[model samples]
Target chain A: MSAELRRLLAEVAERESERFARTHPDDDVLLYERAVAPRRALRRTAQASGVAAVAASVALGFVAADAVVTDRRDATPAASPSGTSLTPTGTGWTELPEDSAADAWRVSGRPLDAFFVPEGPDEAVLVGADVTGDALTTCQVLDAFARFQMLADAAEAPLPEAPLSSQRLGGFHGLGDVGVYEAEFTRRAGAAAYLALMVEAAQMCRQAVGGAAVVNVEEDVAFSAVAGGGMRVDISRDGTDPWRLWVHVQQGRMLTVIAEPGGADEVAPVITSYFTAWDR
Target chain B: MSAWHGVLEELIRQRRSALVGYAYLLAGDRPLAEDLVHDAIIRTFSRARRLENVGAAEGYVRRAILTLFLNNRRSRSRALAKQHLLVVPDVAPPDDAAGDHDVVVCALNGLAPRQRACVVLRYFEDLSTAETAERLGLSEGSVKRYVHDAMVHMRGELGDIDPGPEPTPQSVVLVKGGAR
Candidate 1:
């Protein structure tokens, strides 16, 4: 009976296969090209950088708490480079001075000015003020961290065994503004581990930020791993007024960039700049 | 062109239709079957794998398609949870009742995704129960149960169909290689 059933199944499969083949005959060359484009671009970037197969760890000095406070008072409006428009149209984020923390805050409609308090050698808390000079309390920053930790613990499976050190919390710009937080592992956590954590974290953030902030996990948008040694996961929120949570892991460092009402184009360059500086 | 690119182009030009058809049998949707094939191709070629020839590349792509299909099914609930955020809904292709194989296809779709996959791998792909279990990361007992349940359901739908002698099983070549 099983053999007879198998023969019948094979016959149906062959007929349907032939029908499908006749109906959709043309090869989609465009889809193939689009799928491979990112890979080609990554190869070019690696070749141009002359940094292929070179993994170096540069210790970035913990930003002085006083420095963050002083920089806010000295914040200047972003200046576009000559011959190229640096700012994306209709967005507060400017492409110029790609590594400026001040410019990073502009997307959230806040000045770069913020107070940084050192929590440990590898951890710091940032407090940013609004237009009215109202600043987030240290307790509020800790509360957010607690929430993230709680969500991580509640995940179905435990995160990777790699201990996360070098934790830094970016300034809080209220519930409406973008928030940034980053950490580096004491040891190298494999790319797969980081990707898993990114997905779990993205889902957690989606639940934490109620209201139209849905997570998008389509192949092109959700997760992409660079050939050499980097993995990027973008969990985009709803369209037009999109909220993007960009998680990137390179070397042993993991940077989470959350931008309310921003696009990947806006946050991507900033992330590149941050990694580039770290590599140096 | 690079060797991998040459292999990729040749596979697409020669075996793309067959791959799409195989995916269609598993997915029961033409557009999704196309996506599964394209995604499988990209996944195979993106990483640095030593594919000695077009045959090996095709094998890799077939394996990728199976993996992707299963993973997509597993994540369907998560994707549906945020379906409203999608700019365009992913509507399945309309079923054409005019086909001679509609009964079989409909019965196949009636089974759960894993059960359908097991049946396709077992009967359509002509893989042994152990091979099917290995491919799907399932225990052999589980594969048997799924195939058994699926056949029972399919027989009910395809009542009194003529069961001809079993055809010769086609050999499926899967190449093994470590990432470079």
Candidate 2:
């Protein structure tokens, strides 16, 4: 075939692929309808599967404190362990090499939502949906393209701090106006240890908080501690340290779901994986 | 609800193969593609109210499928990976593209997701640069640069069409000319 023909063909395939990816309106509408009327969609959705629609998370075996039942309607307050301060840092983490497929950081299963954070000024964070938490505590999602660049910049060598046990916090930007009050904490597992967080006032988030007050939606920010059959355990939420659950969101739906210290083992790997897959 | 189910029934009558082909291209899995289409059909049954133009609904349905693909990609890599199950072909992955399909995909992969999106919208969907910019909510200039940069890369990687300046290496910091 002539080169022109091949070029035309590739263009067609590429367009076809792009068009296909963009055509989830059906799924979107269904999700939209379902999001609005859970009972009706739930019955239909569940009837198709012979199960019940997601109304709320059933509190499992945690007996330490009162666990709030979070239905799809509201997010439960994050039961963060308090007292010990959380200092944030992008240190000690070996960022993925650019252009390398983030296979190592790929998410394991379905999540409530996936987040893609921007890595650069290239693609501005176009969408922000989650209106929960302290307005100070929401995660940011950017177009995945810019995130690649940001991840590359963050890929710098660890700050001699091996495990970023302690570091001064600062603000960070994501979507316009949102300032991020960021903090990080270290976690120790069997043989390896890693860092986690409690973000408060930082760049994009803190900026958003300062500039304008956002219209708070009814969805209560939740951190449901789901026990996934395997060796998942809850840490003492006394603020010293606790396990982390990460959710990724895009457009307004759940995109990626992951857990830190994933697979009853390494927390950093899980955290890294969450960051990698978390397209904000 | 998807607004294209009734339309799809008619579309299937007239364009089943093409619709399936689009689904296959989107999901990379035949069964999953059919399931996507079926689900889209079901949802469109309810959403037909919001769909203004019956004739233009096909474009909307197409857009919906694309969004679903991205959502699925975002949600879970492994389970969503299931959507790409290989199937025998009527509409297989168009590997036998007459042009630089590999080049285009690779060049696209090189772009920031947004840039690639810009290129896709401008050339692939045949949208004007301004239309593409509006759709993506980006500045016209940004759209132009994305298209230019994308084309240049596509030229080098896919074919001999020299579109513009060479692409910067992934690791290099983009330097503005420092002629003081």
The per-prediction tally of clashing pairs is: 1, 80
Error of 2 at A137 (Å): 41
lDDT of 1 by residue, B8-27 (tens): 77887788778877887788
Which candidate achieves the best lDDT against the true structure?
1
Label model 1 with its docking quality class: incorrect
- Give per-residue lDDT, candidate 1, residue B82: 30
Interface RMSD for candidates 1 onward, in order: 9.9, 11.3
lDDT digits (tens) for residues B17-135 of candidate 2: 45554555435454566555544443343341455444565665555555454445332433343243223344445444435444544555676655555555554466776676666
How does each model score on lDDT? Answer: 0.48, 0.33
TM-score for each candidate, following the candidate numbering: 0.47, 0.32
DockQ of each: 0.16, 0.06
Stretches of candidate 1 off by over 4 Å are A1-8, A15-25, A30-34, A40-280, B73-99, B160-180
- Candidate 2 residue runs with Cα over 4 Å from true position: A1-11, A14-280, B1-5, B12-48, B52-54, B66-73, B77-99, B162-180
What docking grade applies to model 2? incorrect
Model 1 clash pairs?
A: A72-A113
